[model samples]
Target chain A: MSTAVAHRPGLHSWLTLIRCEAKMVVRDTAGLVVPIGLPLLILVMNASAAGDEEITAGRTALDLYILPLVFTIVTATIGIINMPSFLAYYRRSGILRRLAVTPASPAMVLIAQVVVSLIQAILGIALAFAVAVLAFGAHLPVDLGPAVGIVALSIAAMYALGMVVAALAPTPNSAVAIGLVGFFGLGALGGLFGGRDSLPGPLATLGEWLPFGASVEALSNAWAGQPVEAVHLLSLAVSAVLGAGIAAMFFRWD
Target chain B: MSEPAILAEGLHKQYGDTVAVDDISLRVERGETLGILGMNGAGKTTTVELIAGLRAPDRGSVRVLGLDPRRDRGAVRQVLGVQLQHAYLHGALTVVELLELYRSFYPDPRSTEELLELVELTGQRKTRFEKLSGGQQQRLSIALALAGRPQAVILDELTTGLDPRARRRMWAAVESLREETVILVSHAMEEVERLCDRVALIDAGRILASGTPAELVAQSGAPNLDEAFVALTGKELEIEEESA
Candidate 1:
């Protein structure tokens, strides 16, 4: 009984929010591709071939890269698409104005949304990991603890980035445009499609500072059971703090 | 005689050089329906927005339910309900779903079935907001405002696009909320005269006159509220025409 009370508007509300977010993204066929189906397909394909192709001279394998990359993509997808969708629909429909008069604070709504994105990111990573292990000869990260930390920070950073996009785009089209550009541009450079080595010197160094880059570097390090370097830890911490601060300062529901 | 549910004292709102709500002061007592009548830029919506805590006043204070609307906004929100001047609903959800969504915000939300039935939308409960007629959508907007089972309801242009029959139905619904205070804003004098217990006519961001319909008619020596409105706002109307 005590446990249930501890969760007032707790697990149930969060679960309901997840279902709601899923329904909106799945409302159209095009929306479905971006969230679930596409990520899973990449996970399966990457994991099998990852073991064969030598990622580094040491044969680190592509399967190891898949988990962190999938995590970043899922976080971006949840924020990029859903954040703008939330604002656009509400602003257009005057739901924000209605909510402005309700006891439900806009901050609470945004927090719920961030929670939803985190849940989706975790689910997508789990699925990708499953496919990598089952389909390909992939091993679980040698240090699972730090990998989980990377996931948490990655969600925070991307959710903040998503808010920046949501705040700037007054229309849904603009939001989608901005989110897509940032997603692919940052995702690719941060090692989603390829490793950081392919980039030029300055760009590779710059990638290390990005939210996506921090997660990528941290996760890759953890899979090897190496301690997370100060640079990587600082990068992740900076991304988390800066992203959350800006999101809180700039977020607009209408 | 009782304390007003909504009160504004020397309220002012300005956007740089232009004044949106120009030192407006008004009050609506408990259970009294107040009509906010005005020309296009007369600041009716601004006043309502300030009173609803969507905007803060640059000068003076607004108290609703004995709490400052700006300082105690969340508490005010708990007790007050609002229907926007423009009816916009999230298109992704059905009527029933939208009601349920708002229902979650309150500790004691009204039943979804009861709210839909009140708006005569039970038949279309499964339909998305866009799928409904303009009048039906407006009705649903009003339904959402009442979801919290509030002490006060603000309906801005409640029946703007409604056909005569639908408008009549809306007025009936408004009139039926016996225990709730309502503030209705509209351009139609007939809506004011027919529905509101007391009316405040605004011209150029200020109230021209405020009194019960019978009292205003007796004061103006006009046969109906329409002639009285025309007489009170005739000068403001001329200014608008010349500017245009």
Candidate 2:
């Protein structure tokens, strides 16, 4: 074989990969239902439950709390639960190994998954916000800037943790099991079902230090028009860095 | 003489205590089809992977088109196309979509329509990979391997799961790529005899024999390549028992 100089293409190559990945994500309707459908369902249900009941010193209602919780569930479901299963399936099926021989590195696939998950998270948030505003007459955040910042940081932290699960799980089934454990375990600590103060003193203290708890606190504070605690933001940033570092150190291409 | 398209010397690979490839060396000229023939657990797959840069040898040097597979992996990828045994693509992607995605990796890729036609997948372009039959999936894989217009192509067990008719069709598609340096890893003696310019017979991670089909047949004093393979590897009794 003649050894011709290998051609190096630009960004177009990765764009194609991302497009294909997005198409596959769209086709997986069952997977999308949880991220998109569950949030809308929760929004309507929680809004009905509040029904003219004033929560928190007559200034806020249960609907305000539900909005943040719905946002958490949307980001966590896509970032922690959905992303790992897709990546693990790719690894178990030897798709990563196959891509190693081609000009495209397998890392592109991971980027594609992250991109699609972020898109889903954004869509889920948008749907919840629209429903809350139209049907429940919910007030918008006092400062959109900090609210967006908190949401972005929360997504980064959650996805970083998800990458760790994807790196360690040997199979798709194992990925799902581990991801669900992380989801519910973190969800409870973050007060997805109830107030974190309701938990025992030690558990509440531990939750305060965890990424999910930090994210919930930051988002809840932002939605309630209160200044977010600096420690919570720092914890989320720390979790994002540590979780991503661990995942990168142990990631396997095959 | 021109440099060999692929050269490997003193290859040794092991898994735990089991040796997968032991002191095997090979060279293939440009545009030559070299068949690696071996029985089960004979390390043919490992040898191909080493050559393709998918696996690094425990102790060996492999050069493809004058570049080290490990050190020059990016360059090697630009020139090498591989279809691993029992490998898969995204199940939800349609055949055309998968082809287009792979084609984007290469600077000068063959048109997707042409590739679909070459693999006889024109009629099934819109079908998802999971929905396609076994033969169709295999053909799509072969087409994807050729998407880069690779100078060297490695095909492992290309027709293992296909029906006889599909196998013949696959053979024809492979035959069309005769100008590329192709390393075919297979157990089917007839396929090697029909398509290979040279053959390497491996047994227990070692090369038992190497030559053309006629040379091997003549050396073993056998009626055909199949019996000659049995004679060379000394597996005639085991094969006979299995068949009986």
Candidate 3:
């Protein structure tokens, strides 16, 4: 009998897994387009109107309000909606269970998926920025460092919530349904439909504390050359931690 | 004596009020093919799942290649390839792509072309998993199990839904793996009789008998292993018609 133990999967294996994941994400037409297309549509529709309304020295309402909202939409849609559905499908279809038996652990799938989703998110963000600047003449954020930092935090925060949705959802359809509820629930309160000013006082306050509201507010502050509030940052950090904790506790591979 | 490839001692598992596995013990020597014969819901799949470390036994131990499956899962996974009853794979991946991905997971994996030829899937190399026929999908699953060049392999219901032609082809694939330790879980007596060196009859989460096919027939005073199975387990073997 051969007594040789198998070698651990190397970088080549991970790259192949990630490539497969990327292919799946690309092939799913609706999933591929919606996260990028919907946000771009919203950005274009709002950019022309917001472009003429200058908020500070040179930056318009486009930079402070519309750009952040558009970027937030990109991250939230992909992180909260697309990523979880893929995870739910993998679990439902037993793909994760199948990988568990191989030298390639199932955790590798999750990591590969996250990597692909991050790449998709980056593409969406870059596309939105390109259109905003080239097409609508939008300017960069006054505080570029913080704006970039906030967007990264928002991505992490949204992905954490996506993990929770993937954990609780029994099927892909359920994942989409729950993700939509989450995206809109947070969006509506976070000033997606309109600014939080129009919401009920309590809801507006609640929205300010949620990832969507917190991200938009922080990004808006950074764009407007103002200091981001500690409260907004705290909201995003807490959501990320809590969402990860819940997912780790309840997630099932199959 | 050389250590056995697989050993299970008094394995017991339960789900809620249902006892899925109960006090089952087995030992499979290196390079030996052991057939586990049982009807549906006779804990066949559950038994293999325990050996593969997919589920932790409630009250026993399992070791593969002298390593505890649960404790040494990383090492065991390197040597133990499992083909479950379900064809659980990414639906959109083509046969070759899936084979390539699984191949990359092992340091010494069989080439995609080699696996495709082994399962007679060369013609369907570019075909998507969901697009393959049920038999073809089962064959692909078997190929994936063999991709890692595992020393110990477990195939659960390998040909359950296959047509006779496909079943014969699958048997040929198994025959080529005679050098590896194999635990074949199936309801098909013909498959066991042809491929396995020894057979164990199980019923209601317990082993009814264990011996070579001839020995099983002699012990039960039956005409063949099929009749021996019925006499030992007190259950009629129900062979489903070929559907794919």
Candidate 4:
């Protein structure tokens, strides 16, 4: 309560900004629940339903497919829905504009959001894996390297698209609206609900080139102990580059 | 003599075809509170932004603490604290938490407790920003602007929505910082008279008059600053109808 001022060592503004943003993310129930809850829910529900179904010659539904689709849902839910909503809220509330006048640039806030969302996505993936192993006795991926690579690449691609939504949406509600559309539309076309083959001729061809569909295919292959497809990996990389580039070019502070 | 804490010369800004601030020159000496009095859309906020380096002027130059505000923005931010009219903090952060976070941006900052006490927000330390009353929020915003222990501060529309009691408390808090240079943008004549060492009356993106409260009163041949403001601005009939 004393009016005397004190001098303290200066901390890097970006670190302080990231820590504050992380605290806000933890307090945000809706932001946390969607990325964490929805993926776990899908994992348990799908596991229970696929009790004894064999999708192929020797592979059960849980063994080679459900986990990858669950991973897709995790990445898409965070990158396409949660990230855009949080960023748009910051923009609309003038928090970003306020930071512009401080020593910290608004880009630090964007980086912090991506970092926190990635951490949440990883936690979601780990929880899904635990449930898959214990409740369903699903086999682990033969090689962890390729599986991890596909997951990381997919997340990068999805989050890049999320940045596009955050940059373009004029308001928080519009960002959420655009995010949800991207989530569901990509989920359907990317074979998160089912196999890509089930889609019609033109749709299946188009979905094959999309980052979501490419990621699902690459993840499924890696999980099944097959080498990752070059085209799918390329598509995902291209999507990440293009999406991030566009978002960076068009982002507005106010 | 030390240079003025803030200096702007022939500053002009426009949005599309409409001029916001036109050919305005201002100087605020150290340890002085210069009140910028203007009606709504009088370019008071725009002038503040230009001095704070938040907006680049279409023409003219601005220097803050002897450094070009636009080119030395990073250095200027180190000593220039600004509380913008529409700026907002995160709603979920507690008062103390927000203060501490802002404190980290400066090498020398006032303690959280002191800032809260100065603004009479010590009792609301644990309250979330969204939970605070409008007056409390305004107080917190001011506290944030002062957190860096800045040499100069700009407060735009600082007491616009405050109740009379809250406005008095704000004035007292601002009064406590009399040793630091301050540029206050306000529409309240009484606030300018009580707190400002010198006042500038701006209208339609131009400064109409600049002097102490008494000088302005005498120049306008009015008994008080309120009537003097009206007389000088030629808005006497409008003021009478509004007050009536």
Pairs that collide in candidate 4 are none
CAPRI-style grade of the A/B interface in model 1: acceptable
Q: Model 3: per-residue lDDT, tens digit, B78-175?
A: 89899987747988888998999999988889888889999999999989898999899999999999998899899988898889999999999999
Residue pair clashes in candidate 3: none
Docking class of 2: medium
CA lDDT, every model vs. true structure: 0.75, 0.85, 0.90, 0.84
lDDT of 3 by residue, A1-254 (tens): 44656468999999999999888877777788878899999998888999888878688989989989999998899889988888878877789989999988888999999999999889999999999999999998889999999999999999999999999887778998999999999999999998999999999999999999999999999998899999999999998899999999998888
State the lDDT of candidate 1 residue by residue for B157-190, as single tens digits. Answer: 8887678899888988898899898999887777
Just chain B of model 3: what TM-score? 0.97
Candidate 2 lDDT, B137-232, residue by residue in tens: 999999999998888899998877678899888999999996799999888877788889999999999999999889999999999998998888
Query: Candidate 2: RMSD over Cα atoms?
Result: 2.4
Give the C-alpha miss distance for residue B99 in model 2, angstroms. Answer: 0.7
Instruction: Looking at model 1 chain B, report the run of 10 residues with the lowest lDDT sum.
Output: B235-244
**Candidate achieving higher DockQ, 1 or 2:** 2
Question: Pick by DockQ: which candidate is best?
Answer: 2
Off-target runs (Cα >4 Å) in candidate 1 are A1-22, A25-29, A44-48, A53-60, A168-173, B217-223, B235-244
TM-score of chain A of each: 0.82, 0.92, 0.97, 0.89
**Ranking of candidates on DockQ, top first:** 2, 3, 4, 1
RMSD of each: 4.8, 2.4, 1.8, 3.8
TM-score of each: 0.88, 0.96, 0.97, 0.94
Q: Residue pairs in steric clash, candidate 2?
A: none
Residues A43-123 of candidate 4 have per-residue lDDT tens digits of 788887774676653456776777888888899889989888888888778898777776666776788778778878888
